[model samples]
Target chain A: METQKTHILRRLFFSTLYLSAFTFGGGYVIVTLLKNRFVDQYHWIDEDEMLDLVAIAQSAPGAIAVNGAIVVGYKLAGLTGVAVSVLGAVIPPMAILTVVSYCYDAFSTNPYIAAMLGGMRAGVGAVITSVVYDMGKNVVRAGDPVNVVIMILSFCISYFLNVNVVFIIIAVAVFGALRSVAAQKAGERS
Target chain B: MICLRLFLSFMQIGCFCFGGGYAAMPLIEEQVVTANHWLTMNAFSDLVTIAEMTPGPIAINAATFVGTQVAGPAGAVAATCGYIFPSCLFVTLLAYVYTRFRNLSLIQQTLASLRPAVVALIAKAGIGILIAAFFVNGTFSLAAGNVSFRMILYFAAALVLLRKAKLNPILVMVLCGAAEVIFYCAGTLIR
Candidate 1:
């Protein structure tokens, strides 16, 4: 039984480690990679649970990638799993950045590097736009008036009004709770 | 003392950086670029490119890069830990209670509401990044000029590759980066 636990822990760590080390473009890419590995490859989490985990991760504070790892890790092997998975997700980036930081001056001044970065920035921008489109399709329901309003309002406030995101989150959470209560009350009446 | 300060500042960022890494960009920009003066705006932009090109979360990568820029390796460790500290704590607590309260209607509704908001936040972040990348003058209006046609071309090409051809992100990045180098080197020679 103990051996089984250890084996799972090792697998969790290596898988996360592998994902973090190789995957670039960040955020949703990592989530998709995790889904492919855990849900499709390992069969650790099912399709439905993976979706729920992503939703929870998306709503929670911190990086979605880290949050996803935490949720899946906990589901698979409790606290220990969480620890190993977080470590796996974090270490590779930390190590890579540490090295890059050490040579930043060199990276900054090199014309070739500058051009490469210039191009990479555009590519990265495209990737981010793609994430927004993919996520917006799922999250924005034209059929659901409330969701549509919140989505549009949130974007306008953030982009146009330049409102602080913390305030927006607080307002939305309060609205959500109230909406929930109203929904339940309406259901009870029927 | 610097390490402690780094830890505290990043911990605050970690706590408040809701929605995810991209959404955290503005907050991070305010803290590191404007408030702390740890890095100039140009440097911060460069770091973002580096963060995207490299593996890991953008927030984590930013924390490490900014910390290292401000201090050193110890600073990197301090900042990285501080950034993730909230996540480790919150996710654990939430994970425990969430399993038991998974059926709670309030929780479900809260999540439902938050999802659209998260989408908006990500969209805002995406636009912010796009403006930063494509608009060389730092203004949203193209009439202000300084628009980089090359950047736009690259962006369109990459978007097409990803959306139409369904190419891998890594491949797109590599191809674009290489194309830029070749273009720039060739331009210099022709000039």
Candidate 2:
């Protein structure tokens, strides 16, 4: 049991490390990659569980990637898992920045680096669109009209209205909580 | 003392940075550039470019870079730990609560509702990045002149490869970068 636990921790560390090291375009992209790895590849977590983890990560303060690593880590092992995963997630950025700091001008001014980044951003955008499609499909699969409406409204409000995401999340969370309470009461009455 | 200051400053940014991603940029600019005077606006812009190009959250990259500029490697560690500390505490606590109460109907319903909203948020973020990727100067314009054909090709090709070929996303990203380098070299040769 002890060895097995250690092995799982090691795997968790390296998985997050590799994901963090390669994932570009920030939190959403990394979260999408995490879902792919954990749900599709490793099968450690189910689709529903991954969605819940993402919601929590998004609603939380700080980098969603770090918050994501923490929750996924906790789910897999516990607090110790959280520590290892967070360490792995952070190591790449710190190491890269440390090196970049030493040669700031050369690193930042290089046209080749800029061109590569431009292309990667395009690729990153594609990956994010795929994530939206997959996650949106799951929401639509539930056949909840209200949820479908909410999804559409949420997208329009955020994308078109340019509202702060924190407010949107808070609004949806309250509506969800109130909905759950109402359903509970209705069930009791029935 | 400087390390302590860096830790505290980043801790404050971490505590207040909700929604992550670009949301933290203004707060960071205010703290590191405006209040602390750690970096000039020009240097901070460079930092932003570096953060965007690099493979981590902008907040983490910013913390590490600013910390390194202010002090050294120790400063980087201190600032990073401070930045991530709140996330660790909050996520661990939330995860514990979530796992413990997952079977509860209220938790389940709330999660069910949250699922759609989260998807919307992801969609919105994706569109924002897509515009940034496909348009010139990261602005949306209908003009053909404003469209970046090369970036559009990269986007379309990547989407096809990911959805059809099921290629590893990291590998796709590297391929796009390599393709861009080749294109750049070819363009220079033609000129």
Candidate 3:
């Protein structure tokens, strides 16, 4: 068990640090890559579990990487995994960026960087879109048409209606909870 | 005083940031643009734009950018560390407790309940970004819109490439960046 703990933490650290190093756009993009690596490549927890990790991480009060470290760690090695993973993710990015800090004044307004960023920004958005669609495949399953409708509605509310995240989350939680309760009662009845 | 204030303010942002950096933008707008009066909406928007292009959370990038702009290297360090401290502290402690409570049924039940709600938030957040990224005049239309056609094309193309091809995102971004610069120059020369 102890040897297993070391291996898991080691793998998580390297994976997250790689993400921190390469991820240029945002944390959401990192999450996508993470889902690919941990879920697709390693089969760490499968796709649904990975989506759940992202969801919980998103709703929690912290940086995305930190939340991921915690949740993935817990899933893998209880608490120790979370500790090492979060530390791994946070330290490298922070350190490297601080070094890059020395160049901010010189390079911040560079025309080339600015031009490249314009395209990269749009690409990041696209990546997010693709990731959401990928995640939706599982979250919105064929067994339930409600998941599909809820997803579409939520998307509209967020995009067009501009609803608060807290409100949307509360609505879904209440609905899912009620459904679970209803299912339990029906189970008892039968 | 200014440096100290920026440090503390960023710490607040970092501590309370749920989701990712983009999700924290509204609050950041409130604190930096509205409350502190350090920057206008335009400046904040520019900062966000630059932060998005960089390699970390916008919150961290904001701290580094603003800190450097406000003071210097020390300010940057102060603000970045302040922003990160809360999560580091929280995760370390939570991991410790979680290690001890791995098999607890109540915790399992609570986590299960929380998962779907999380999906809603993720979906909602995606919509919000999509709307902001694409919508114009309270309606979303890719045709005959004021929004940049290049951006939309990149978005659509990248989505297809990502889903279909086994290409690296970094490589895609690099190729797209080169194309954008070429197109930008061509547009400028034509105009």
Instruction: Please give the fraction of native interface contacts (Cα pairs under 8 Å between A and B) kept by each candidate.
Output: 0.76, 0.78, 0.44
lDDT of 3 by residue, B102-190 (tens): 33333333334444344544554444344444443323565667567666787788777877895666666566667778887888889
Provide the global lDDT of candidate 2 against the true structure.
0.81
Worst 10 residues of 1 chain B by lDDT: B102-111
List TM-scores for all candidates, in order.
0.84, 0.66, 0.60
TM-score for chain A in each prediction? 0.76, 0.58, 0.57
DockQ of 2: 0.45
A52-115 in candidate 1: lDDT tens per residue? 7776676567888888888888989999999999999999989989899888889879999988
Off by over 4 Å in 3: A1-64, A67-88, A99-109, A142-157, A166-190, B1-97, B104-145, B187-191
Using DockQ, give the best candidate's number. 1
Give residue A143's error in model 3 in angstroms: 3.7
Candidate 3 — what's its lDDT? 0.63
The lDDT of each candidate is 0.81, 0.81, 0.63
> Model 2: residues >4 Å from true position, as ranges?
A1-89, A100-105, B1-83, B92-105
